[model samples]
Each structure stands twice: as C-alpha cells, then as structure tokens.
Target: MILARVEGSVVATKKNAKMTGNKFLLVRPLVIDSPTAKEWKPGTSTLVVTDSLGAGEGEIVLIVQGSSARLAADDKDSPVDAVVIGIVDTVDVGKHILFKAQ
Candidate 1:
C-alpha cells in the first residue's frame, strides 16, 4: 500500500465487465518521508486506482497496489493495480499535519 493523492478520474467505455462499475482515479504516489530529507518528489507516473473509499479529486487517499487491489474488491479475476482502499481523514505526524479530509 502507498499514500497517494487523487488527481483526476478515468472514463473507459471499453473495459473489463467487472471494471465497468468501479470508479477509476488518477493518482500521484507520495514519497515516503525522510527525517533528514532535503528534497522530496512524488512519482511522475499517474496510476489508475479503483475507488472503493469514495475518494474525489485532490483528496489524499490510501492506495493498495498489486494483485491485492483485486482482492479488495472481492474480484480475484479483476485486472487492477492501484486501488483507493481508504480515504485519509487526517494525517498526524507528531506536530505535523500532512493531509486532512472533511
């Protein structure tokens, strides 16, 4: 699983039958924070993640990658990589607040 933020959505008319009803989101994978980091950059690749947590654009979400994404939907045959498994309500790291959702 990875921490990512929903950037947009994808609409595909020609997709697997099981994927028809699922919401697909474009996300940017967040870089793991380092205590002594001077620079941090998010991944350039945009991932298509199935939205199970009802996430929206600009919403910070928890994404489950690999075959586990299919398992989360209970469709082992579904072809999916990244999936929005949880909507991040708030991120509290000591005295830092990274992301928050209302």
Candidate 2:
C-alpha cells in the first residue's frame, strides 16, 4: 500500500485477458509533510493501479493490499498488484487536517 496520485489514464491495445474492462490508471507518488521521508516521485514513472477507489483526477486515495483489493473490486481472478481502496476527502491527524479530497 502506498500514497499516490492519478497522473492520468492508460490505454492498452494488447493486454492480459483478465485486465479487460478494468480501468488502468497511471499514478505518481505523492509527497506529504514527513520528517523522515522528505521527497516523493511525483512524476518519475507511472504505476498501473486498479480504480477500485473511484478516484478521479487529482483526488487523493488510499491504496491497499492486492488481496483486499481483489475483494473491493469484486474480481477474484484479477492479477492487479495495486488497488486504490478509498477516496479520501479529509484526513484528521489529531489537530491537523491533512487532506481534502476535492
């Protein structure tokens, strides 16, 4: 599981058969205020994450384990390794509002 933003969509003319009908999203890692980790790969490369979280452009989301993701997407045979599970509109860390979805 990681924190990433949807950079854009992906189109595969030829792909795995199980991947058909599944929306493939290109993601860039996000950088939050972290004392330990200072930088993030915002656009270095893109990951193909399943859109189980219903995340739109620029919306921050929560990604989870592939097993859990398989359940979320209702695709037991999906070979996806990464899955976006939640569309986070707001995040509260004690007295801080970390993010607002859109």
Candidate 3:
C-alpha cells in the first residue's frame, strides 16, 4: 500500500461493463522527507484509482495496485490497476507524527 492524497476525481461515462458504477479518483502519492522527518510531500506523478470508500478530494488515502487492487474492488474481475483501499486517519513514524486527519 502507498499513501496518497485525492487530488480530484475522474468521470467516465463509457467504460467496461464491470466498472459501470465504480467511482474514480485522481491521487498524488505522498512521500516522507526523511525517516526522522514529520512532513509528507507530494510525489511527482499522479494516478487514477477506483474508489469504493467515498473518499473526497484533499483527503489522504491508501492505495493498492496490481492484483491486490482487483481484490479491493467490488468486482474482482474489474480491470483496475489501482484502487483506494483506506482513508488515512493518522500517520505515525517512530516518534514523529507525520499527519493527522481533521
């Protein structure tokens, strides 16, 4: 799993039959400055992920890829390469608290 922020969403009126009702989100992966740092920085690239947990824009989320993503989706056979698996609450790295949800 990887930490990411939901930057926006994707609307696809026409898609695969298995993905008819699925929601898609645009997310940027979050990376820590350092092991001892308490800050999270946005990754350079963005990704579109399937969402079933109703995650909104600006929320930090957890994402899974490949076969794991398929398992996280409502339909296991959906052609999903990435999926939002969880909405992050807090991120604690050792003694430093990296993030907290409001």
RMSD of each: 2.4, 3.2, 1.1
TM-score winner among the candidates?
Answer: 3
Candidate 3 all-Cα RMSD? 1.1
lDDT of 2: 0.71
What's model 1's lDDT at 67?
85
Residue pairs with backbone atoms closer than 3 Å in model 1 (clashes): none
Report clashes for each candidate as comma-separated counts.
0, 1, 0
Superposition TM-score, candidate 3 onto the true structure: 0.94
- Judging by lDDT against the true structure, name the best candidate: 3
Instruction: TM-score for candidate 2, please give it.
Output: 0.73
Ranked by TM-score, the better of candidates 1 and 3 is 3
Using Cα atoms with residue i matched to residue i, what is each candidate's TM-score against the true structure? 0.83, 0.73, 0.94
Runs with alpha carbons beyond 4 Å of true place in candidate 1: 32-41
Count backbone clashes in candidate 1: 0
Clashing pairs in 2: 89-101
* Model 2 Cα lDDT, one tens digit per residue, 56-95: 7777667765688777777878787778877767765566
Any runs in candidate 3 off by more than 4 Å, and if so which?
A: none
Better of 2 and 3 by lDDT: 3
Q: Which residue runs does candidate 2 get wrong by more than 4 Å?
A: 36-45
